[model samples]
Structures are given as C-alpha cells and as structure tokens.
Target: MDELFQQADRLSSSHIRDRIVEQLYKQSNQLIKAGVTFSKAQHNERTEKLDAIFTSPIFGFPIMLVMLGTVFYLTIAGANIPSSMLADFFGWVEGYLTVSFNNIGAPDWLHGVLVLGLYRGTSWVISVMLPPMAIFFPVFALLENYGYLPRVAFNMDRLFKTVGAHGKQSLTMAMGFGCNAAAVMSSRIIESPRERMLAILTNNFVPCNGRWGTLIILSSLFMASGFTGGMKSIVTTSVIVGIVIVGIMTTFLVSWLLSKTALKGVPTHYTLELPPYRKPKFFDTVVRSSLNKSLSVLYRAIKVAAPAGILTWVLANIQIGDTSILLYIVNFLDPLGQLIGLDGYILMAFLIGLPANEIVLPILLMGYLSTGSLMDVDGIEDLKQIFLDHGWTWITALNMMLFSLLHYPCGTTLINIYKETKSMKWTFWSFMIPTAIAFLVTFAVAQAALLFGWG
Candidate 1:
C-alpha cells in the first residue's frame, strides 16, 4: 500500500485525485445498479426549484440583497422601542446611583467617574447593543437553521475563489453582522490557515451589531428630511443595503490585494453541500442565538466599556490651559478629521469609542451637548436638531457613515483577532489595513465633495 501511494504521488496531484474520485464513484455505481432506478429523479421538485432560484447566477445576488435588506429593516424597526425602553431604564438606574453616591459623601470627581462615567458608559452599551443584537441574531440564526447559509456560501464561492480566499469566508462574514469578534472565532471553520487569517483580517469590513445601530440611526435621520410614508422606509432600507454591498465589495478588493501580496497563495477548492431547507426550530434557535451570540458579545462590550466610560469622563473633565483634555485631543485631531469630512468631536468619539462601536454616537452626543456626560437625545428630530446646531451638513453625515462602515474593528474584535491569530504581527496588520482603507476612502470622498461643492 505504501509503495502504491508513492507511485500515485509521481503523477500530477490534481490528476491523481481525479482518478481516485472516479474509481470510487465507479465502484459505488456498480453496487447501486443492483437495485437503484437510474431513470427516477433524485431530488424533490420543489427543492430543485428553490435551489434554482436561490443559486441562480442572475437572481442569486438580488435575492440575497432583498433578504439582507429585510433583515436590516426588521432589526431597525423592531429594535427602536426596546432600545428606547432600555435607555430609559438605564437612565433611571443611573439617577439612583448618583443619588446614592452623593448620600455616601463620595468625592465629586469620584462620583463623576463612577456614576456619570462608568455607569453611564456600561448602560449606554447595554441599551444600544442589546436591542439590536437580540433582534438581529435570532433572525440570522433562523436563516442558518433553515440551511440557507450554506447556499449563500455556495453562491459566493466563485467570487472568493477569484480572490484566493475560501468560500467559507462568506459564512464567517455573515457571522460578522452579529459580531466581528464572534466572526473571528468562527473563522476556525475555514480549513486553510491562510484563508482563515484572511477572513479574520477582513471581517471588520462588515458593520457589526454596534455599528448597525449607528448606521440605522443616521440613515433614518437622513431619510427623515426628504422622504415619508412607506417610501421613507424603503429608501432608508435601500441606503443601508447599499452600504452593506460596499462593505462586501471592499472585502473582495482587500482580499484580492492581500492574495497578491504578503499573504499570496492559490485558492483551495472545497465542496459545499447545500442542505435542503426546513422549518426552523424557533424556540431552540432563539434561545441558542440569544445566549450564544447576543449575550456573549454584550458581555465583552461591557467589560471594555466600563473603563472607557471612566476614561472619557476624565478627558472631558480634566482641563488643560483653557480646554479640557478631550477638547485638546479633538483639536489635535481636527485637521485630519476635517480632511476626512468629519469634525473634531466626531473623531474624538471614534477614538474613545474604541472600546465598543456601540458607544461612538453616544460619546459624540456627549461632546456635542457639552454637558460633561452622555445624554440620550430623544427622537430622530431631536438628534437632527443637535447635528444641525453643530453645523452638520448632509455631507458630514454621509462621510461619517462611510467612515464608520470602513473603520477598524472595535476593541473587542481587535482582541479576538490577536487571540485567534496568536500573532501580534498579523493582528497589527489587521488593524492598519482597515484603517488605511478607511482613511483613503473617506479622504477621496471628502475631496470629491469639496471639488463638487456637494452639501
């Protein structure tokens, strides 16, 4: 047997593998012929029709877009009430904490740091992160449970192959919509080490649940001024869908670049079986997805966000000369931020929001309110008024959306990448690559807007 394997190895690997597969099929067919009816159709007609539509070269992508848009629509529309309730509950709790701290005669700075800073930060994260994750993950898991996820991978396999990455990267990218850190962990499903690393590096391109909350908020605000009725909802959903498509395109572009550069490799072929769709087990899916994906991600975000809240409070409160340290940092970052079509406050928010993407807008609102604390602005109209007061043009909103979509992964995701890759070098590149692309894309957009005098 060893000598026979050595002889087979002398031929081209592809040819040898093909011959082995042919021989195996030949033997299997001989036994199957004893009782099988060769004329009978193998698959159910309905299953075949569904696969034809879902995996069609032309209709496949559009179907995917429609489904994706529907999921986002449901998440955005459904999460609003829950998010508001959570925010209110957290705010009420914060009030009690503040009163208790004062009654205890805690130092003013300590009160600010603990109640106003740390408590508020964690609260904002939960209030913002939980609703979306709770809504998004179950719906996504439903698709997975119904076995449509593998079909998605099957459809995108050709494109990923072109980029020298595994088609399984699509599976991991889908996981990113729930949480990038989870997506990094999911990359283990890819058998190829190089492709797995590629997936980890590019997973940040997709807007995770935290970033989705920001995008949905901004997209709704953008639509509010010009659209109404069902049209408004349609337009808002379309805009978000468009942003998601752009992220996917960016993922492809970056994958192609990496394939040709430091991570050069040939794409490995793998078979993907599209399982028959079935009724999703609702209760099991909901329980498992909520506990496994939503709560797990929320816990990580809270861990990082607690310290971030205290740090943000310190920066906002501690003054240097005439400006607070927060303002000074914003001032220093202003020119670059302007070049990318954002303001000092916006940039500052992103910096401090490093702990969790869910906190970016909250931190920005805090800065804009100038209250030395994060304030929950009620309604899209109130949020719009704040932006208008701060001189936010549509261009500013648009560029910020673009930047948010393209920016580096949140701190939790970064840590996950480090742990998964077990290489600081790969992890650093994972950070730098996305940061570079984000700045370049935003800079070009900013320059184009300036040249065209776009609002």
Candidate 2:
C-alpha cells in the first residue's frame, strides 16, 4: 500500500533497520502461531548445557555471594603485607623529605603542604587502593571473560523489570563494576525515556569499582575482628558482598518506587542475546580489563584527589581559635552526619570524594593525617585503629558503606547522566532522588540500630 509505504518511510529511512524489524516481527508472529513449546527434558538440557547456575534463582545468588567473597578474600589476604610495606616505605621517605626541607630552609607552609599534604595523600592512595584493585579487577575480568557475567544479568533481569526498568539494566549495572559513569552512559540501550531515566538515577546503587575498593577495605578492617584464618577472609568477603548486594537491591527498590510514582511506566520487552562461552585470552584480558581499567580510573582519581589533598592539608595546618579549618568544617558537619550514623570526617570524605569515589579513602586519610606530617598506612589493622581513634563503630562503618553504595553519582556519572538524558531536569532528579533515598535509608539504619542494642 502506498500509504503504508509512506508511513514506513517516515518511520525508518534505512532499509536495513526496517527490514530487520519486519523480520523479527514476522518470526515472533510465526512462533506465536506455532504455539511454541519444548519438552521438560529439552528445556532442562538447554539450560544445563548453558551452565546457567549463575542465572538460576536457587544457585545464582549464592554463586554471586561466593564470587564476591572470593574477590575480597583475595584483596584482603593480598593487600595486608603490601599495604604495610608501602606505609613503612613512605614514612621513611617523609622523614627524609622533612629533614631535607629544614636543611634547605623551606617555608613552614611550603613544607607542610608539599611534604605533609601532597606526599601523604599520594602515599595513602597507593597503600590503600593499589592491592585490592590489582586483585579484584582481574578476578572480575575472569568472571566476565568466562561469560558468567551475563548469567548475572539474566539472574537479575526479572528483578529489574519488576521495578519497571529495562531488564538490560542488570547488564548496565554490571558495567557499573568498572565505572558508574560508564554504566550511566550504557543506559542508552534502553529505548524508553522513563525507564532510561530510572536507570540513570539508580545506577549509583551498584558500587563502582572505586567504591568497591573502599568497601572491601573497610569491611576487612572493621567487620572481620571476630574471625581468624580462612573464616576471617570468608566473613570479611561476605560482609562486603552483602553490602554490594544490598546496594543492588536498593537500586531496584528505588527504581520500583520511582516508576510507580514519579517515573511510572511498563517496561519494554527485549531479548538479551547470550553469546557462547569462549576461552578468555589471558594476556588480552589482563591488558584490556585489569590494567587498563584500573590505571585509567586511578589516573583520573589522582588528578582530583591531589587538589583536595592540598586543600585538606591546608585546612589541617591553619589554626583558628586553637582549632584548624579542617576541625571547624568537621564540627559543622557532625550534627547532620550524626543523623546518618556518620561523623564529620566521613561526611567530609564523601564531599571531597566528589571527583571520584576512588579518592574517598585517600581523602579520609589526608584529613586524618592533617595534624601530622606522617603519610601512609601500616595495614588494615592500623587503618582500623585510626578510624577507631576518631570514634568509628560498627554501626558507623556499616552506614558509611551503605551511604557510599546509595549516594549521588560521582561527578563523572553526573556528567554522563546529563549527556544521556540531554535534559537538566532529568539530570537534577537523577542526582536528587538517590540522595534523598540514601539519607532516608541510612537514617533508618542508624535509628534502628540505636533502638536495638545493635548500635
């Protein structure tokens, strides 16, 4: 029909696009007419052959739990010695620098900011961040390489759709493993405007690799005190994994709530194509997934962290009324932080961590070391002592982890949300809703803990 052709022409300029849609429609109709069915054994055989335990509800979540545990187990087990080594190495360097600065008659402020602030910041970054990232990313890549990741998506797809989001959001959330900004950008695959916006707003619930590093470290330090040997690793890893899973669950919960209220809609249907498993190329996976992802993200973090480090250093050294600027800021933030089971330093870390979640720990270290010129951390144990000295408790640490998992997208992700939505209102809400939810959830957690003996 001329009219039909005209309408089709208006809808699709490219022949291939129209043809593919037409073909898929035709095939779907044919299957429907045929009353598509397969034997129980046949279905079982298909699922079994695919080795989809990673997607089975009974086994999938447990697999995820184990995988996450293994990654953190490796990170905690691997990072302890290197973290101590780096700390001792850097402390010696700091002493050398301080002496050299005195000999050269360097200005007090100059020595303070450079040797105390910048050097300490960089040292904290290397000692705290390096080992975990080095171990986690490669293991994650191996899972990804083996086609297990898609199974994760498949397992979680139904949950995502129940929230009126694209099922593919599971895949995008998986992308958040490497970076939240990348995950937000990957939302373009969602064709619906409302669903896409939901994806952008909630993507932060999946901890980016940087935040994952922080959670792993903090959980190992704070939550593993009662256990020892392999059990310690298992417990620490389980806690971190539990936190990650909670984050993901929060994403779905928030998405569902938003869809029912502010962003309501039926989810669009899509068939996720599962590629066959292949032997992952070892050298290529290492180069592309592990080294490249880690280094690129680390480089971006250092740029932002360096300036914040300098600022915090200055705040620490400059005293007003016997209290430094850092203390003043922390005092100001403490009341609000109290409601959320965090303190000023924790809040400040999140604020300064705007540039990259990767830098939050580094920033916290910088803040702590502000009064001293010593840089570097001895180990998770030493880091725990520092946090404990500053009034950290199990509730505080748990809520901090929760807040990190639920809070606003990092600066990079906000920029990506803007690019994806091309609307400032959507971008603003994408930041707003998650922040509100993070506060509420954290507040509830804190209150509940205090109400019980748990706090």
Candidate 3:
C-alpha cells in the first residue's frame, strides 16, 4: 500500500507545490522585466503601489478596517434622510389607502387585512429596509467592481485558514451582506465539506440586509442619543462598526471551536488570485446595484412581510378572553425574553420574524400599540418615543443588536442549508447553534449589567 502511492505523496505536498509556484512566479517576473518595454510598466503603476499599502504587513488589516468603518458610516449616515422621507411618503399613502377603502365601503376586516396588515407591513419594509440596502449595495458594488473584494479574501485568508475555514469563506461572508441564503449557495466555492459547513453555519454572524435597519436605528437612537448633528452620526457609525467587529470576532471564535470539535478537520489550501484594480463606472454600478440587488431584495422582503402582516393582524386582533392571542403569546415568552434583557413583545416579534426579519420591527410596533396591525414609526423621534414607552434602555438596545448579529438565520437560509447539506441533522444544528449562542451571550450581558447596576 505504501509503495502503490509513493509518487502520489510527492504530488500532494503543499509546501513543495507552494515553493514551485513561487519559483515560477519569480521567473515569470524576471522574464517580463527582460522582455517587456519600459513604456509598458503600464497604467497599473498605481495598482502596484496601492496593493503594497493595502496588503502590507504594517498597514493591511488597518486599511481593511478603515474601509469597513467607512462603508458602515456611509450606510448608517447616508440612509437617514432618505429613509425618513420614504417613511413619510408611505405613511401618506397608507392614509389615502384607508380613506379609499372606507369610501368604497370596504369591510373593516378587509381593510384590516389589506390596508393595515399587508400594505403597512410591505411599506414599512420598503421605507426602512430599502434605503440602507439601496445605499449599501451600490457602495459595495463600487468596491466589488473596483476589484477590492478579492483583497478582502486575501487579507482574511490566513486568519480563516488558521481557524480551519477556507479563505473563500470571507467572500461568502461578504455575499452574506446581501443575503444569507445567497451566501449559503456561494459556499459551494469552498471545496472541503467541513469548511463549507463551517462557512454555512456562521454566515449569519455577518448581519444581512434584513437585520441592518434594526441595528442602525437602535444604535443611532440609543447609542448616540446624547450627540447631535454630524457627531451623532459619527457616534452611531462607530457603534455600528463596533458591533460589526463583534460579529466578525464571534465568527472567528465559532469557526475555531467547531473546527476543534464536531467539524474537526485539516484546513484546505485555496489559491487566491488578486485582480488589477480598475476604476468602476460609478453611475452604471449604482444603477445595476439599485435595480438588481436592492430592488430585488426589497421585492422578496415585501413578499414575506405581506403574509407576516396578515398573520400578525389576525393574532393581534383575535382575542382569547380579555387578551389578544399575540399578547398572550408575548406574555408567555416574557420571562425568557426578560432574562435576556428583551421583553415579551421583542421575543414574539423575533419568533414571528423567523420567516423574514424585515417584519420584526413592525410586529414589535403593533404589539406595543395593540393596533391590531403592524406599524411603522414616522421618524427617529417617533421611534425613540416608542422604545422609551416600552422601557428600552441602553442595555436593551445593546442586547438586541447583539442578538440580531448572532441569532438564527431566516427561513430561506435554513431551507438552503438543508438543501446544501442534504442532512437534516446538520441543518438542525445550524439553527440550534446560533439560537443557543444568541441566548447565552445576551443572558450574560443582561446579568452582568444587572450585577453592576448598569441596567
């Protein structure tokens, strides 16, 4: 048996292969220098210099972090006014819709289901979720078009591989910025089954578009409350970036632990190709991202939120004795939710939001107002008032943001996990693992806050 594969062992030595490739590249560079003309040092003179700074030992990760902070800042700060405007327009439209339904002699139940339930939920999703995604995807597309995403993979590769994940998992995590379900599918790029599974399970650690609105609003409303103007936005962005760093660090920890336990395996080598950076056509990139990514995601969110609205309306309106069914459920979950620094309504909203996270805020608002239908706040001030009315402190806001980062993936992502793995056991683990982690992390924070009188 040893003799049969003696030559194969030599072929499979990663060190030898790496050295050979390095020598080949070195020779290729020498030949290019000898043969190529000076006039053709080329337009990528800037590219070489940028790569040196961007990928340097001294500056590489710092640049990456700066870029990340910048993106979050833009997404958080830039989305504000447009989101408020969209909310106003949607509110106006909802009022007109209610009047139209009344003038047409529509039944109260019909109005509740369509106008109050479906329309409100869908509009809230559009107004809140759309602007961030609209701003985020275009800027991300700009970075992607300029060929910087691969550098992200490159910069994070050693860390991931050291933690027993594939380098390309970074790319899938980036894709998770768009959609976790899509990121699950994108994990196909990882050839090793164990590493691929690791990537799939941890993809939710990088908050998706569905979770962004909640984090941004909560951070701005609570974390930056004392500040005003540009200072407020800066503080909000910093908090958001801090939350993102937590998510990323959690990903690394989970990947490491799983690699040392159930998913234990040797890391597989992935050859990363760095492409020449090109100036992206900003307008075209924006148009394509807005139309292709943002609008498409918005449409899917509406489809899910619409049905959620109907269910929530039925639950909130239908009574079991003196209390609505939704309240009863919230009451049942209150003890558990309180243990984690969130209330019953927040828990119920999260459970309902399993289908689509965009609906969580609306359901929470409905639960707060007992409105028999989902609601969208008029502005940040209105939202702040609502949260205050519900006893939301900074601890609550912080815990909620952490849970949003760590909780179970949406239904679509779960189904994709099942389909991708073809193993119900693994899919169940994926759901349970993140859910358990979220509860445990929040419980610790809540307890620590209480012990120190910080709550």
Candidate 4:
C-alpha cells in the first residue's frame, strides 16, 4: 500500500488514483469473465424511479421541503394533546407539592422557591420538551432508517459545496431541527476541521426542537385567525414551515459569507453513497431514538431549568422600590426590544429562557401574569387575549418568530459548540454571528413595517 501510494504521488500530474481504479476494474472484470459460469443482474425499478425523482436538481429541493414540512406538521399536531396532558399532570403534582409544603410548615420563601420556582420549571421543561422530542426524533429516525436522509444530504451537497462547506453539513443541519446541541455534536461526521467549524457556526440557523415549540404556539395564535377548521390548521402549518424555510435560507447565506470571509477555503471533494432503500425497523428506531436523543435532551434541559427557575423566581420577587427587579429589567430592555419589534417582556423572556428554549413561552406568560409562578394558560384563545392586552400585533408576532428562528443557540447548544471546537473564539463567533443576523433582520423588518404603517 505504501509503495502504491508513493507511485501515485510521483504520477500526480496524471491523476494516478483514477488510473489505478480503472486498471483494478479492468482486471476484476477479466477475472470474473474467466472464472464465473453465469451471472444475472437484478434491479429494483421502483427504487430507480424514486431516486431519479429525489435526486433531480429541479425537483429535489421541493421534494425535500415537502417531506420535512409533512414531518413537522405531524409532530406539531401529534404532540399537542400529550403536551397538554403532561401539563395538567404536572400542575396536579404542583398542587400536591404546595399542600405538602404547607403541612410540613415550610417557610413561605422556601416554599415559593422550591415549588413555584424549581419544581414548576422542571415540569414545564418536561411537558414542553418531551412530547415534541418523542414525536420528532422517532419520525426523523424513521427517515434515517428508511435511507432517505442521505439522499437529502446528496441533494444538498452541491449547495453546501458551493458555499465552501462539507456536504455532510446538511445532515448536521437536519439533526439541528431535533436539537441544536445534538447537531453540534454530530458535526464530527464531517472530516475536515475547517468545514466542520463552518458547520458548527451555521447549525444554529436551523431552529431546534425548543424553538419549534415556541414557533408552533405563536403560529397557531397569530396566523390562524379568521380561518376556519382545516384552513386554520393549514395556515398555521404553512406559517411555521415558512419560518423554517427562512432559517434554512439564512443557514446557506451565512455559510456563503463565512466561506468567503472568515473561514475562507475551497470546497473539498467527498464521496457519498446512496444507500438502498429498506424497510425501517419501526419499534427499534423509536426506542433507540427516544433513549438516545429525546431522553438525553430532556435530561440536559432539566439540569439547566432548575437553576434558571430559581433565578427567575428571585428576579420576579426581589423588590426594587415598589416593583420587582424583573419589572425594572423589562422596562430597561423595552426600548431596544420595541426597536426590534419585540417588547421588554418578550426580550426578557428570551434572555431568561436562554437556559432552555422550552421555558421561554412559560416565562413570558409568567411575566404577563405578573405572578412569580410559571403557569399554563387555559387555551390558545386565552393566550391570544393576553398578547392582545400587551399590544402584540401581527408585526410583533412575525418578528418574534423570525428572531426565535435566528437568535443565539440555547445554553446546551452553546456548551456543545464549545466542547466540539475546544476554542472560546469559535464558540463566541458561533454566538455572535446568528445574534447579529437576528438583530439586523428584525430591525429591518420593523423599520419596513413602520414605513408601511403596518405597526
């Protein structure tokens, strides 16, 4: 092998590897013809036609988008009932916790911190994070098992290569929709260090499961108005799909910019095998995905939620003159937030919800309620009323969705980026790059809305 490699290096001008492969194929054919008695070739016509459709440049992207949108629609529709059920269960548990604390003669502050703060925070995390993960991951894993995921990467390879990134980045971006932290960790599949870094920096542009939960809620609340039944569902799903498409476009644009500037490099060639389509092992895929991806994400989120819950509780309760510190911070942030088409409470929610994106909606509702406890609202109508009371318009909701899609990665994702890169500089860029894009995009939209008198 060493001698062959040396000879190939010496004949580099002739592209020796191609010559070697050609010669090897020629010899193998000769040997087969001489030794074999008979041979028959078999082909699957269905797979061939499917591949032609899936890999065609004109239709490939649209097909991929449709498939992705279908998956998201199913996950969103499927997770709702379970999410509400879990919330009710947790809420019941909270009632028991409060009574138990009272019976034990726990101090008011301790009870407030333990029950309203830590316990409620963990409950919200579980209720919001689990259902989506459970639904989304297994569906995604089915795609992987069915061998469609690589075709997705194949379809996207040209675009990523044009942006001077590894084609495998497409797979990582897909993983990001399940969880950005998991996606960041999955960047290892890319072989080149520079391209891998590009993948890491750009992964956050794909909204993760946590952000999806918030986006779905806002979409249902704002976009479903004036439409009935099926039309309503269609509009909501389309709006969410539109936001996801924007995130994907942003990923490509930023990847191009970084390739041309900061992470300058030419695209490296790579081979991608289009695996044979096979029957997916449904039970095994679901069990493995739930244990490996869903549960792991839930665990990481719970760890951060507990401490963040306590801190948010403190901020909401600690008095500053007549108002709590939380109110003071919101007031301070309101001006900039408004400039970006979001209010102080929304901005504060994003900041406080940094620990876990699953908690942002809960925290925002808590802020609106002016209660120290994070509580669930009655339904979509009630939530819409609360937003209307706070002067939330279509512009506000749209920009909020945009910002959520483009903003900084959650705490777990940031930590994973740091771990993967082992450099504070890249991790910092990973944070600032998306955040800068988010601010600029929202600011422009807000300005445009104001100019059109849509604000």
Evaluate all candidate structures by whole-model CA lDDT and list the values in order: 0.85, 0.79, 0.89, 0.85
Query: Candidate 1: where are CA atoms >4 Å away?
Result: 1-34, 37-43, 95-107
What TM-score number comes out for model 1? 0.88
Superposition error at 299 for model 1 (Å): 1.7
lDDT of 3 by residue, 1-455 (tens): 88757765667465566778899989988998888666636666777888888888789998888898888889888888888888788888888998999899999989998988888888888989988998899999999999899888888987997798888999999999889989999999998999999999899898899999898888988999999998998998889888888889999999999999999998888788888899899999999999999998888899899999888898998988998898899989999999999999999999999987787888788778776665656567887898899899999999999998899999989999999999999999999999999999999999999999995
Q: Which candidate gets the maximum TM-score versus the true structure? A: 3
Q: State residue 135's C-alpha deviation in candidate 4, in Å.
A: 1.1
Error of 2 at 209 (Å): 1.9
Clashing pairs in 2: none
TM-score per prediction, in order, is 0.88, 0.85, 0.94, 0.89
TM-score for candidate 3, residues paired by index: 0.94
Q: Which digits, one per residue and each the tens of the lDDT, describe model 1 over residues 276-314?
A: 778899999999999988898888778877887787888
Residue-level lDDT for 389 in candidate 1: 93
As for candidate 1, its clashing pairs are none
Residues 1-455 of candidate 4 have per-residue lDDT tens digits of 99988877788532554477669868977897788644332334466677999888889989988998788778778887898899889888888998999999999999878888889878878987799889889999999999899999989887898778889999999988888888999999999998999999999988888887788878887877878666666777888888988988898898899899988988776778788788899999999998998998888778877887787888898997899999999999999999999999999989998877877876777677666677656566877998999999988999999999999998888999999999999889888999999999999999999999994
Query: How high a TM-score does candidate 4 get?
Result: 0.89
* Candidate 2 TM-score over all chains jointly: 0.85
User: Which is superior by lDDT, 1 or 3?
Assistant: 3
lDDT of 4: 0.85
